[model samples]
Target: MFDVAITNGLFFDGSGAPGAIRHLGIRGGKLVAISSEPLEEGAQQTIDAHGQWVMPGFIDMHTHYDAELVAAPALRESVRHGVTTVMIGSCSISMVLSGAEDCSDMFTRVESVPREHVLPLLQARKHWNTPADYATFLDSHPLGPNICSFLGHSDLRVAVLGLERAVDASVRPSDAELRQMEQLLEQALDAGLLGLSSMTNPWDKLDGERQRSKSLPSVYAPWREYVRLNRVLRKRGRIHQGAPNLVTKLNVFAFLWESMGLLRKPLKTTLITLMDVKADPWLAPILGPLTRTLSRLTRADFRWQTLPVPFVTYADGMEFVVFEEFPSGEAALHLASQDLRSELFRDPDYRRRFREDVDKRFGPRVWHRDFDDAWIVDCPDQALAGHSVGELARARGMHPGDLFLDLLVEHGPRLRWRTMIANHRPKVVEKLVAEPATLIGFADSGAHIRNMAFYNFAVRLLKLVRDGEARGQPAMPLEQAIWRLTGELGEWFGVDAGRLALDRRADLVIVDPQHLDAGLEAYHEDEMEGFDGLRRMVNRGEAVRATLINGRIAYRDGEFAADLGQVRGYGQFLRAG
Candidate 1:
């Protein structure tokens, strides 16, 4: 007998096709049938998805859940929103091939997760030393969703070169060291990792007393080192998740060129982001066309990840990564002591340099840096009374840059402010997401804990399309939207997921399209259960009526199964195909 049956549901099948009313039978963690015929009546459980749209569960291809997957394997935050698969080891951080301390240092600062919680958990439980063992560790845990990961370049580099030497800018890997890295990557691929994820973004820093403020180890590698590793991925027909040196942005073409098959088999490259930033209005318009040209003309297979919704980011005093874009801001953050940063914030010389940079408005910044664009969302000081940074600066007759530094000196971390960094222009954002060379991503889920809240990005994208179609300006077909979050990504990543074919793994969600609305944008907080009262920003919505991972209803009827991560039924480690 089938374990479950979903009847009269609008099935999308993750194929970018129109949804059709169908009945699906699930048996033994696989799809039993995909047909319009009536489901045989004797299923042990049944879901009457009368009006709901059933599709393959959304795949979250960008997440920093590497540590959280260890701390709380359920990871209900993404699962609740219909994400049944989560990709970790993003931005050159992964748990494989590194010691607990090294992994913790590499991750905590860049991802903004608490090291105190992550480090100790790893120190106690992290015994695995290789990619295969890491996969085994995950299998032992009651994972909430299928997990796929890239072998982080930083992890391999640090493991082979020692953390001290890896982060040192002057220390280049020897030929021997490069071979070791390749060997580790080969091991990772053999262990079924998605591929290699590398970082050229200098803003992502390492944590720990020794490596503090140093950019991730991947940032220390030279172009030759990267090319050597990229070859391994290319040869294996694996993906390369890359981020350009954002400060310079010249590396973008370098990555794209490597993705071309003109001289060799194209490496399937997917880069971090393409957004309509307020700081550079011309960038997105140019990039969309250029990327499409490269994709078609070069016979290259690469996709620029795009966020489908508005990019709102939160910052507390001076703890945001955008600061790393400029010298003065980076100097302040480089200080290990919070008091030192505060003192530097008030230093006249430092302020002079920062103000000069602000006036010049440095090229290629994600944040607009306009004080008017940022607002004080929370502050303990009663006198300021929730004014935008620009208002406070204007009141004091000081430049917004100068006033912002002064605020940091006084109310660090306690003073929370938010800004719409990019993707704020709805029409422009709609077009950007629709680009053929772009993929629906950059959700940055499980990263930027305080700074971002795009957990429901999939639903938000759906909502964006739904709202647009209602106004008679459809960005693309709704079926296409679902496919972007589902089959497109799953196919690209080579995961055994994101389709509702008969006999396929029963991984799907029931989305209530009628209830999908603006409420999905609302953000709230849930205290991270094991993390010493740390509150994480999360999205809450009713659109996801049910999420089934491998034939089990992990979340349904507005409630998560109580035993989710405590039991093995919810999910298991999913190796890359």
Candidate 2:
């Protein structure tokens, strides 16, 4: 008898075959049969999958759960979205310990993880002291879904060379240091880490804030290590990196080419979301030529993922304030940057240099642009949710800047606004989404805590592609979208499970796609730590009826089974084996 059976279901197997009407029989948590034949003796349980779509569980390739995973391993946010497996340690930030030295300073500077949040956790509950040991800790925990990590290059840089010295572009590592990092990478790979990942960007606070003064060395570390590590991995595992900054576009293109050259094998490297911004018009200019060259000459593989949404939702009255605008707004921000931000604020000549180099070139554009009263979708306070800060300002007869400043001042560092400025038009999204080499992603779920609304990416795809099909400009086929979100991602990463094949691990999500709406649910304060409100989210397959990991139910109905004692350690620790 089968352990479970789903009858009358429309099954779209991960192989891209046409949908077939069949009943799926699960035995020992793997799909054992798909036939019209009546049940053998007696199945333990059955589900009427009627009109629902059943496919492989999703694989989220890009995520930042560095600190959060240490606290809550159930991974509620991802499992809720039908994501059965998630890859973290992207953008060169890793949670693995390095000897007895306090690497907390490295995280604060490179990744912006708050010292308060990281230090306390490291001092208290963090048990692992090396990459391999950290992987062991994750294996020991009761994780709800499968977790495979990458050895972040930033961590490697700090481990080999001190954080202070690793940033220098010319500071080539000593042969011993290089060998040590290589050994560390080998250890992590043997411990089951997927590959290495990194990101490159200079600091700039969006919202038309002041420019971040001084160039740091960490920026060069990621690019240098990309070539070094790819040669070592020999394309055994994939490399994931994010390169969205305009200032570094040229550098990014060069580094991408360098990494591809080093691969010299049929291996894939995924570049993060190519944002739909006008300033980034050269995305195709760079990728188009590179694709042609790689197909004709190089045996390497290159791919990109797109978000199909704005960098941030502008409905929250948030807009990206480029560093170019910082000079004009320098006076206000510099005064504001005092005290806690005094390290950067203390340099008066640097502020003067910013003013001279910045304001002289872009004076009128910063002064005259009208961003007065734009409609907003959600706010921390429900009363102010839909109202614009500009409109509120006019009603109270104050300048829009004052209203914006007041909120930032009151909310302090936590103030954030979603923006629609990146790709203000749908045509841009359509063109990018239809590209063959592109996959749908850029759901920076655990990152950009105050600024980004990540849960909306899946819903946006449904709305734009499914609902907008009549326009004859749909992004991708629903079947392709499903595969891209699930099976394809796993195949790209060399993970074991992104399909419903027999003998494979059972990590699955049951989602109701129809009721999924394109609106952000208000903040619900129910995280494990009780850290106030987080934006409540529901995607196409959000109302997860059940989530199974390694043939056991990890989460079911509305509660996490790990917490409910339905299963013990349903998650499996994946190694290179």
Candidate 3:
């Protein structure tokens, strides 16, 4: 008899094929049979998914859940949204291959993960000194979704060079250091890490008050280092993922050419965090030619990972790293005391400098030329709540910057503001989403916890695409959308569980499309330590009837499966085949 059976469902199968009525049989945590025949009577458990659509569970290709996995083993936010597998250690940040103290600081700076939350947990747990040790550590603490990690280049550098020297912009790894890094990569790959991930975006800065904080360690690595790394990845049949410098078209195009063309054997390259650069209109023109050039490259395969939703940031204060783009913004962020920062905002000279810097740096396009797009979401003064910064500035006959400072002075630094950063152009977003080459991910889950919550993006996108279709202009077929989230990404990353075939891993999600909701509500939860009212976003989609991981029901009927004991580590640690 099967362990469980799901009957009478419309199955999308994650194959980009049309949906059809099907029945699935699960046993020993694998899909043993899928057919039209009803196999419910002999099963120990049965789910009558009569009106739902069953598809392979989603694979979130980009996330920063590396450190958070141990602390929050349930991974409720991700599993609730039907994500059964998560790819962590993206943008070159991972806990393995480095000291715990250094990993804690790096997680705090690069991913906005609280040091207090991670440090104490790491101290209590058995130390993981190598990638294999880390994998074993993860295996001991099971989560709701399977996790696959990449060896972070930053941590690799820090392991070879001390943390102090690793961040030094001028310092380059010597031949010996490079060889050490290569050896570590080999060890990590053998230990089940997918491959190496790096970050070269100049804007991707480490959060701290110290010098050499301008860019991540991977940014300072010479091109030859990357070439050597790529060669190593090719030798092991692994992929390379990174965020290329996108400040200019030439920078992006050149990086692509070099990354793809430098090595004799093409490595599967996944470039991440691609978005609609509203600040630079020339980016659109550059993408067209660059994509064509990448297409012509025979050896390498390239795909851009993007978040198709509007780029909105909701933050309580200048603590958000995005504000660091403006001069002196970094200084304000580094101030340990919120009251001290508030006092600084009240200073006339400081206010003047902020105004001048904002004007000089961002000019009118700071809010994408729409000042009304930036508004106060929560404030101490009830009258100011939901009011735009522009409106308040106009009322006081003050510059927006001055008014912003005045508000901070009045309400302290904890006033919450929501700003539309980019991707406000619906047509542009639609175009990007429709592109076959673009991978539908960049959730940044388990990172930027307080500043923003994008963990529910998968369900949100499903609702958006379906809702658009109901309005007549479909973004893409539902089958295609499923494929983007599942088979396409799973295949590219060499994961075998995205498709709903016989003998495949039973990672599945059941959705009632007719009842799916587009709106998501953000709430504060004390999930992380030291940070009060940490924000988490949850999909309101009651349509998700059940989600199964490895044939075990992880979530069902708007609740996580209660049958699984207290240590609900039902998830497997996925390794590249």
Which candidate leads the pack in TM-score? 1
Clashing pairs in 1: none
Question: Can you write out model 2's per-residue Cα lDDT over 129-244, one digit (the tens) per residue?
Answer: 57778877887776666787877776677677865466566688776877788788877877888777665654422111121222322356544555667666764555545553
- Lowest lDDT block of 10, candidate 2: 205-214
Give lDDT per model, in order: 0.88, 0.57, 0.75
Model 3: runs farther than 4 Å from truth? 207-214, 246-250, 261-263, 281-289, 297-299, 361-370, 521-537, 563-569
Candidate 1 lDDT over 1-577, as tens digits, reads 7898999999999988899999999999999787788965668889999988999999989999888877788898999999999999988888999999999999988888878888998998888999889888877888899989889989999899999999888998899999999999999998899999999988888888987888999999999998998899889999999899988999998998899999789999999889998899889988988988977899899899999988989887777888877889788777867799888887889889999878776576777888887888888887675678898888889899888887777888888888888887898999987898898887888888888899899988888899989999999899999999999998999988788898889999999988788788886878875577888788898999999999999999889999888878777677876
Q: Which ten residues in a row have the lowest lDDT in candidate 1?
A: 358-367
lDDT of 3 by residue, 3-101 (tens): 889999998888899889998899888889888887745888899999888999989889888776766666777887788999988888888877766
lDDT of 2 at 456: 41
Q: Select the stronger candidate by TM-score from 1 and 3.
A: 1
- Candidate structures ordered by lDDT, highest first: 1, 3, 2
Residue 147 of model 1: what lDDT? 89
Q: Compute the lDDT of residue 492 as modeled in candidate 1.
A: 90
Q: Could you tell me every candidate's TM-score relative to the true structure?
A: 0.97, 0.80, 0.93
